[model samples]
Target: MTAQGLLGAGVQLVLVVAGAPLLVGLMRQVRARLEGRAGAGVGQPWRDVRKLFGKDPVTPRGTSEVFRAAPLVTVATTVAVVAVVPFVSTSTVPEPGADLFVVVALLTAGAVATALAGLDTGTAFGGMGASRAITILALVEPTLLVAVLALSVRVGSTDIADIVSATLADPARVTSPAGVLAAAGLALAIVAETGRLPVDNPSTHLELTMVHEAMVLEYAGPDLALVELASAMRLTVFLGLWSTLFLPWGVATGTGVAELALGAVLIVVKIAVLGAALAAAEVFVAKLRLFRVPELLAGSFLLTVLAVVAALVPA
Candidate 1:
């Protein structure tokens, strides 16, 4: 990798790692304020993570290595995604790694690791959560793949960097019918994949309704801390990816210090705006009943299919 690419990757890594929790906190604060509650400040997630790390480690009895390794696997896979994806700069190194398929696989790997960890726990909640999580994953991954493929068809390349660069060059594409449809489908997939409102509630602990929270119920201390941090990072990463793909205007095209710095600032701003909007929207909506989720995802899949068709049609 060139020094420029490495530098860009380093900047992105640091940005995602440091900004993830703050993004979560910001969303929570937004929701709290809209509901007329004085919420915990944006730094509360950092404080909670710190406290969890300080506690004694605990592992449930009869748990195997899968339970112990899931947290690390999730974090590692997400970090790899952040490193390769062109969040701050299009001049990212190892461009081939930024292939849409590769990035999707990394995301899927992390999800699979989490599901396996849930199954390894052997508790009723754990098994239930794992089954539900896998079900969501099965539906979500295909939608994610097809949604991005709709964009890729126009660019003639499946590499994410190429798609972003193409969109940067042709700003009008963002408003085109295909672009609008793909964005909608991708946004829904992100909401489902990240366990957000109307799909799975991050704040819910009720076993009957829990998906992500149920799987991790048995973890404690540092392990739980890792899971929590990874979850935050995953949300940040997905939002960043969505922003880069659909709103790539601010991304740096070069490795110049000034460009990279500006790109970093813009990326943070884009994510913050999106997070606040999502949080605000969540306030007015209720989670869909469990059986209705697949229908929602199916609608997303249909939008993406239409997007692909639109992209393929002669102008």
Candidate 2:
């Protein structure tokens, strides 16, 4: 690997792992202020994660090895997400090499790992969360894949670097009817996939309203910390994908350090916009009842189909 590739890969991983907590904290602060309450500081999530790491972990009795290993596996899968989706640059890590299919698969893998861990504990809440999560994911995964399929169809490639490079070269490609629909579809899918409002409430501890919390009910201390960090990172990864695929204005096509730094700034700005938009949207929208959630996802699926059809049209 060239020095730039290695450096770029390392930077991508660091941003996802370290900076992810800040995104969570930012969302919380924005939500709180919008609701007329002073919120925790943006650094609060980092403190929370720190506290989690300091505490000792507890393993549930009678649980097999999977329960014990779930946190690591979940975080690892999330870290893998940073590799496939370009945040700092269009270039990918030389080893795994980014592909659209691989990106979708890795994103799904974190949920599957956690769901299995939920069932592994033999706890009712964990099992319930896992089941509900799986149901939601069934809808989410297809929506995400089809949305990307629409994007790939336009550029004739699934590699993030190639797609972004091509789009940069011809800014007009992203202005097509299909691109608009796909962008909208992806926005909805990001909300659902990241467990945001109108889908699942990340702040709610109530099992009745929570899809993610239920699965991690059995986790405590650092184990819980790992799960939470991974969750935050997962959300950040989705936002990164959004920034890169639809709005990759400053993403580096060259290996120059100066270009890479500018790309980093641009990516951060895009993600910040996404975070604020999500916080604002959550304030006005009520969480959909579990059954109604599918309807929303189905709408995104339809949009994806339209996006692909629109892409096939001659400009």
Candidate 3:
């Protein structure tokens, strides 16, 4: 990669790491205020991360290096994802990182890392969390995969950059039936992927009701910070990908500094709007019983199938 590309990639990495916590804090603040209480400021997650980093990390007896390193792996995978996800420019940094399949694999790898970390702890609750999270993520993956596949089929490219570039160049694709159906499926996948309401609750402390939290319950201090930051980054990247792929209105198209700067501003605006909408929607929904989760994903699967079929239709 050229020096310019390296700089751009570094900028994207900083955005994912810094912006992830802000996004989480914003959502939490919104949720808190909507429920009629004073909320922590949007900077709260950053403060929490700083506090965690200053403290010591503790690992239980008999735990292996995989347990100690899982948090780092999760964070690194997310940063790598940000490098390719087109948050600023329609072109991914380093160029070759645009495949939709690769993005899915990276996302799955992060989840697997979390599961392994949980299992490595050798605690009953930790193993329980790992099993539940792994199972849910495995089910969620097919819908996400199929949704993107529908988009790829519509545009005739599996490279996210190319697919998005085509969509931006042709505004009509935004309104196509296939696009609409695929977006519906992707939206559901986003919810499930983020561990949000009606799928999993990010704020829940109840052991029986938590999936993401249970796995991380054994972590403390800096390790916990990495895990938390990774979770936040995962949520941010998913939202960014959703915006860049589906609503890519202001994404940068040129290599100019100005274009990329404008793209950055627009990304913040788009994700903020999306975050608020999600928070408001969460206020009204009850969590689905675990057994019912598959039904939700199955509905997304059907919509994606229709989207794929719709893509084959004459325009």
Tell me, by lDDT, which candidate is best. Answer: 1
Please provide, for model 2 over 6-78, each residue's C-alpha lDDT reduced to its tens digit, 9 standing for 90 to 100: 6877888887788889988888999999999999999999999999999998988988888878888878887
Better structure of 1 and 2 per lDDT: 1
Clashes of each: 0, 0, 0
**TM-score for each model:** 0.98, 0.97, 0.97
Model 1 worst lDDT window (10 residues) = 89-98
Give candidate 3's whole-model lDDT: 0.86
Cα RMSD, model 2: 1.3
Clashing pairs in 1: none
RMSD of each: 0.9, 1.3, 1.2
Best candidate according to TM-score: 1
Ranking by TM-score: 1, 3, 2
> Which residues of candidate 1, in runs, are more than 4 Å off?
none
Q: Across residues 162-271, which tens digit of lDDT does each residue of candidate 1 receive? A: 89889999998999999999999999999999999899888779977999988999999999999999999999999999999999998988888899999999999999
Question: Which is better, 1 or 3, measured by TM-score?
Answer: 1
